[model samples]
Target: MWDTVLIVDWSGGNDRGASPKKDAIWTGVARAGQAEDPVYHRNRQLAEAWIIQFLTDEHAAGRRVLAGFDFAFGYPAGFGRVLTGSDDPFAIWDWFAAHVQDSPKANNRFDLAGQINARFPGIGPFWGNGLARDIPDLPRKGLARHGHGIAEKRAAEQQAKGAFAVWQLSGAGAVGSQVIMGLPVLARLRQRFGADLAVWPFEPLTPPIALVEVWPSLIAKTIAATCPPGAIKDAHQVRVLAQAISALAPEDLARMLDAPGGTAEGAILGLGHVALLEQAARAPVLRNDCFALPQGVHWTPVDQALAHLRQHLPPVAGVQPQPLAAAAGQYLAQDVTALRAHPPSPNAAVDGYGFAGPAGTGAQRLTLVQGRSAAGQPYDGTIRAGQAIRILTGADLPDGVDTVVMQEDVQATDTAITFQGPLKRGANARAAGEDMAAGQIIARQGRRLTPADLGMCAAAGIGQLLVYRPLRVGILSTGDELRDPGSTIAQGQIFDANRPMLAALVHQWGHQAVDLGRAPDNRSILRGMLDQAAATCDVILTSGGASAGDEDHMSALLAGTGSLALWRVAMKPGRPLAMGLWGGRPVLGLPGNPVAAMVCALVFAHPALALMAGGDWPEPQGFTLPAAFAKTKKAGRREYLRARIRDGKAEVFASEGSGRVSGLAWAEGLVMLPDAAMTITPGDPVTYLPFGSFR
Candidate 1:
């Protein structure tokens, strides 16, 4: 129900009495259809001040916000009673508010944790403050002589596998200090916002500013691969969480906030969005129900879903066998074993004379035999001790012959051959099974056969191969402003480029591209075409009707007859990438802008289609080169600028608009910008991915 979603990656380290420097606190923002770059915060105080002011400004503008903090908002059920003299978590929040102290330079998290631990009678429910040298209650490690605090983990933490115990107050991966330092900020937020803000699980979630507990680890596995290497861990975490939360639909978000027993660690959203969609699509086969899912969630991550699909989705089910010549570009459904050894038997490697025994000394001459050995015609008789047989290249070696000298180094006459050079035992001869052995696995199941693979199978005597059928792709273009190229020109109408471009790309990728034709803004026509495409094609691709414009019909169509998996991915020039399933077939809705549509198709749709076609997704190949241009980019959204390599440097297009189709035509590749706030200097290193790699 919110218009803006913010994810906070908080830290509890003592900024050493100064503002945090790096790997500290990070915050990311995602609006209804736009994801803002993440902002770095040096300390909790600054972060709190910014959040308060930002939320105030947004609320003043009548915008609703869903803000999630990455820290426990409450303690375990019974611990709340011991800490605040009540079983209610809100009471503990109030207690922390009154007891904790924070500033840009320092915080009393360790002292407060020690104070709270003293009430419980043990070393911990709170321990580990390496910064506190003289603290009696909170030791750096191990229990004190008289310490015995409870070691209870919150239900949400336990449900989130690999989650650290909340009692571990210090050391690596410990969130206890964060809980103590962060709750005070939440308490202040609640006080300032009052009824405007609602803490999930503890308060009614109907407020304009909802505060929910979040664990980035819940969605980390799904997005980790997409994140750039050597990126700041905290910044990356918040960005991923923001993207995941922004991608969730309304119903799915509600189910996550409504999860049971999330009062302590807070309700983790974006962890169940995938599950809700899976449930709606009746694709629960990938869900493992044994683990405790937050409330109605039976979800799996995108990587997990892809893996499951790759494993269980049989190679085009019941595909027919095809000849080796027709197997190129298709996935092999069965393993191919070598039928016979290569070179069937030992053969000569060159046209020469075969000698019975090795040449004892240099300049040795031998009398030639009447029989000759040529390819496909071997002599029946063996050579005598002082005689040699004439052998041609690829001819099988006769009995009593072990080596052959090159014809160029020998003198030959009718019925006689002479070699004047010493011969090695096995020189110039190909041994049986040298290239391939009998019963060897030349190709395994699920391998996409290439031309070389087909030739290898042919050499191994495999005439036919069992392979998956070709993937069928249906392409569509939607919008009244879009008209087929070469049609009569009309006012305010642009020739359609997305359909033909996408169709050609699909074909180049070895799929059968079916042109579903151009669709107007009419819902009936769009729905009919979508229905037909879903029923007949393996995947449906469309452009121009995915946004919120009045003419946008893809969203409504998916909402009515299908389930939209994700909307508005956190990407520049291509935020409006809508993905879902219609009639059990996958649909990738790209943007209408030619440049954005092409980039989205390559970066997202391309890999997705590969996975659907029972083939491994191709990783984007790139090389590092110095940038020949300079620009400032935002963090949290990935951008691919039309660029090319010139003078050994990467150069970008002059204009950065997604509608500039000429940029794609003018550039040979793209310059990839990671999701971060940074200034690119002319000599700085940039990643360049050639367009040919995608093709």
Candidate 2:
């Protein structure tokens, strides 16, 4: 049997009406076994009788119910009016309060007090006597807190006594106003009711509601009344409706709901429809919360940790560059000034003959003067008619010379030159400040320095540039049974490969890696090395000694020093990872097993380096590849399998032990298998994460 959900609208309206325009009866019937759906008529006597009878019936049935409503059960009488003006209003609580005030017991002191006290137990004195007193200037600062406290208390009473899960949704108006007025009340209820009182804002046009609200009238009719099993024909129809509603896109729905005339009531109905459809569709419900590490917990989700760090880290300030050599391959420090401190005197761009003419395009011949002018030198005397001077690129054009015929264009005849084409004023001439202007942003902040950028800065008379300092990473490995490569192992000792692998990884990320000598299986010596590294390096990474075994002393040392942030992450192979502060510096402890250490480092170290380098961390790169062979897995934790690419598909490599170094050599990348997915057939798309050049 499925759980029952009740959607109650306490506003003044009847489910059925007689007149075509006035009669508003819902003809549709709710699926069998669901809770009662009631539209509380504004008629106080009738509504009170109906509510009492409904509660009596529910109490006799002994079944728990989850109720969703459009109004805040704990809202102060005038709170809604304050947010949404009373003229364009849909104030449920206000109507109820007015109805209560005008009831037959209006003259009865006990009845009036009970009505007010039901929602605000101790506030009758303030409303009735405080303003009437001579000292009416009493502080009202406690009113808001008092109101919130009462709302929470009432919501708790509803949940504990009635076994209810109450959901309060907002209507159309100022969204900010609704949130401000509604959230505090809902939050108070949630604190006491726990999951039983799940409160989320319902935007009618959002995906979740659209998916469920497709047939709003039908769902609303069904929820508004009780019906027998045969009246609705098939119960699965409800499920189908729910599934379809749940599948609608949220962005599209939000657009629709945000349109004019979209009201809180409309949004509530939309959400109710969605919920009903989901129930009928038999869709799975997902419970999600912001990622966080519990007290004393070790390994945390990499995304969560990175997000927290970003919030706490201060903004990086811009700095000027040091020198040209240091600025090589770096972004420009600032905008470059123009090549010359002041504008250059007018010059010619080409090395050719200069001449004086009528300053227009139609020109025929020019006599060449024997004098020559090279760059940085100019012909001092003015040119005569039909006369020209030999000039080089960057040399000032003599006065009265408005054009330069290219050397190729001039046909030399001893001391004279004949022009084949028309010559125009200002043609082939380099104007002052032609390349760049002074004080322009020649280089922007945060841009990577390129050859063109460097050249431009140098041309602008800048010799140095400022850049972010490189991140420093220290790599260390621990194990008495480890030996460096090329050194013969004695007895049970194995080769130390983690240090080199990690160092290479750090360098690939553009960080400076300092290789700290290996530590034997001694806690005191390991602690001292870690302390020293933490004092100098931005991040300290060590392999081995993370587990809780006798040889696993890294966790202990970290705990004794500063503070241990996390000791273990809920990941495979790298489950016993450690993260903490040592002597005010961050430390990451990886498992001693070669493959495990490398994978963990990729998952964590790469992101840390990017953050420290003043760059946004890149998303984990994933590729789709077919499974080389069939594999079975437990349906809980994510799994990564080492595989090689063959024929554009992933081929699983045999021998995947965490301690096996040969596995790393054979595999090109790792394949991520999502949790709750047990088997994947050949040709099924699986995400491949590359570790080498393939990335």
Which candidate achieves the best lDDT against the true structure?
A: 1
- For candidate 1, list the clashing residue pairs, or say none: 122-147, 122-148, 122-149, 123-147, 123-148
TM-score of each: 0.54, 0.44
Measured with C-alpha atoms, the lDDT of residue 466 in candidate 2 is 51
Report the CA-based lDDT of candidate 1 relative to the real structure.
0.74
1-695 per-residue lDDT for model 2 (tens digits) = 11233333222222222322211211111222211222423333443455335434543574332333333333323433433344222344234334332232222222332343335333421222112222232222224223322222222223223221211111221121222222332333334344333222332221111111122334443433433543432223333333223222233223323433422322232332233232223322111111124666444544455565554432121133357666653333233445453235668779788876444454477777767777767888888877878878888888767677788877776688777656666777766666666665666644546677667777777775555445568898988988899988898888998999999888876667989979998987987898668545656888988777777777778767545544455456576666665644456788899888988887766665555444455457787877777787775456677888899888776776888888888888888777564777888888888875321
TM-score of 2: 0.44
Clashes of each: 5, 31
Note each model's CA RMSD in angstroms: 19.5, 21.2
CA displacement after TM-score superposition, residue 126 of candidate 2 (Å): 70
lDDT, candidate 1, 357-389, per-residue tens: 567666777788787899999989877787888
